[model samples]
Target: MLYDIDKERSALVFIEFQNEWLSDEGILQRRVIKDLDAFRDAVRTGARIIESARSNGWTVVHAGLDLRDDPDYLLFNGGRDVLGLRGAIPRAGTWRDKGVERPAPFAPLRGEFVVAGRSGASVLKNSTLDPFLRNRRIDTLFLMGFATHVCVESSLREAHDMGYNAYLVEDACAAFERAQHEHVRKHVVHHFGAETNGAELIARMEG
Candidate 1:
């Protein structure tokens, strides 16, 4: 079913899209740049979504990965590692630590919402995203960002559980692997919310 976005009750939560994942020299991109065309397309689509949402009066939120002060978040704390993220974790201020600090293909415009200074997979977990959403009375959420099967999926599930009607902008998000990307879009997205393309979302906003 195609859901119409009510501007007054809707919000667009862009997860990640930070320099560490999107930039050409970023760590994750360096590891997966060979297959990054899809991811890049997703980011571009996300940018369009933001533009449409902005003009349509839908709330915009930037859920960034700000791990600047807490470098040992994943290493030391086992309780918070619900995602079971293993291996070397990237710390902010490092050579590979690029987030909203530097310009990438997308950056938040002035006076827009930003939920920065976070280390958790879900923006709601480590940031004020939940409170902000609640404060704004935003019930419908349009989600987009990097690592579709990881952080994006994690947050999607959380949003669903939180009783928000969420939509995953599939073309506006990417996984590390193409298989992973397709897997989440095919199987997992429905479990949380409807999967939508940028064009459809933009059309809905424009309408």
Candidate 2:
């Protein structure tokens, strides 16, 4: 289910989809990877949301996560071989290289800020994202990206508190741990009123 908002005042926040997050060598249960597919679907769903919304003159902001860029933005696994953000996220001005290649349903006519990430927890961690979005008067935020329980959840909670109607694209987002995702979504996030999918959201935006 989706919680709709004013498309004119909403911004799609694309979180971490850099090269490092996609693990081609790590060994994990295949069942867990199924949930991780949300990361891919999010790219597809988020792109379409961005396209449709941008067609209606909404805002589109692409933000990524990086650890080596800044030390302060990271926590827990900043310098070690922590599985979270230990890979090459994405280089600035070249994020598209890591993109899934589906065209956005609502492409923006104006330029957007593709803010770089500093670490695993850096998407909304001590970043200029809040002020930047608020300065643009973005009241609702639709987000999809890597680490559903970490960056995605963190940003969702923060954006919600900051007065932005935030939603998590369930099928379009995922986490490093499926158990963690289930735990947070069913309990913690339930207390915060966040949406968890894109099907209905896309329809609402179209309507």
Candidate 3:
């Protein structure tokens, strides 16, 4: 079913598009992403979505995880390391690390909101994103980006709990393995929100 989206009440959120995850020299990319070409393809699709959003006057947000100042692990002391590196992932100085930068296609524009201070999987955690959305009265969110099963999933769950209508752009997201992405789409996404590809989402926005 095609839902009528109010562009004024919707926001397109890009999560974890940092260099560390997408670029060749990125620590997470080198360590986790096996199919670089496939991941890049997803990012390209994301770029097209962003362009559509911009042209349609939809709100744009870029959420990034920057741990440059968490030397004491105060913000990341969960001890449930999923990366299997024993809490070594998202290394200190990641904020200043070259990997923290967004890829050229995903970079935020002059007026676009860039949310930071995210030290965890969920973009809404410890970040002003929730309040930012609330302030703008944005009720619908279009989310896409790296690690579909991780950060994107986390945010989808949280957004549901927060009463926002969340839509996951499946083709605009990627994970270390194709199976991981499929698992989220098949099992996780429907429970929290609906799934739409970049093309469908853009079409909805334009329509």
Candidate 4:
């Protein structure tokens, strides 16, 4: 059966599609970029998602990556990005060397009802987003965007504990490889407790 949700009360989260993240010079693994056109195509789908979310007056928000002053998060913080991620979402100043920073462009809206587009294996793993969303009483998250296995899976798991309904857009997202995408999508929806994608998800909301 499909999820019959209240679109007016829902939100769309567009994770990590920043210029820096998608550029030819991104900080992502070289092979990771290979399977990204699906995500690119998903952009058009995501745009529709955003427009529909906004049209319904559902909160639409963007979430990528960032940190503050911690050393442990250096890799994700831009210290050891193999693709020279400096051109990606999180900046050293914005992310951390060993700690967490406020989610830029997302701080003020943090406590409001919304969605997340985070890209990584753990969007809310060690971040303050879970608490932030809970405080806002926002209970549904439409997970859409890139690098599925990594960030997408991460956020879905956390949303479970954060007590929000998490939905993954299979068509709206892509993993690092055909294999990876299949694995993660199957695992999460079949075993991890996330709503699997149904093309009509976008349509029902638009109605």
- Worst lDDT window (10 residues) for model 3? 77-86
Which lDDT tens digits does candidate 3 get at residues 171-195?
A: 9999999989989999998899998
Clashes of 4: 21
Question: What TM-score quantifies how close candidate 2 is to the native fold?
Answer: 0.67
Of the candidates shown, which would achieve the greatest TM-score relative to the real structure?
A: 3
lDDT of 4 by residue, 87-205 (tens): 34343333322222222332324334332433345666555556655565667778876667767777777777666787887777777777777787766664555554535775676
Candidate closest to the true structure, highest lDDT: 3
Better of 2 and 3 by lDDT: 3
TM-score of each: 0.85, 0.67, 0.89, 0.68
RMSD of 4: 6.4
lDDT for predicted candidate 2 compared with the true structure: 0.59
Task: Give the C-alpha miss distance for residue 116 in model 4, angstroms.
Answer: 12
lDDT by residue for model 2 over 36-139, one digit each (tens)?
A: 55555655776676666666555667666434434432353333454443433221222233332222342223576665433335366567777787787877
Q: Score candidate 4 by TM-score against the native.
A: 0.68
TM-score, structure 1 vs. true: 0.85
* Candidate 1 Cα errors over 4 Å, as ranges: 71-83, 90-97, 100-105
Candidate lDDT scores, in order, read 0.74, 0.59, 0.82, 0.58
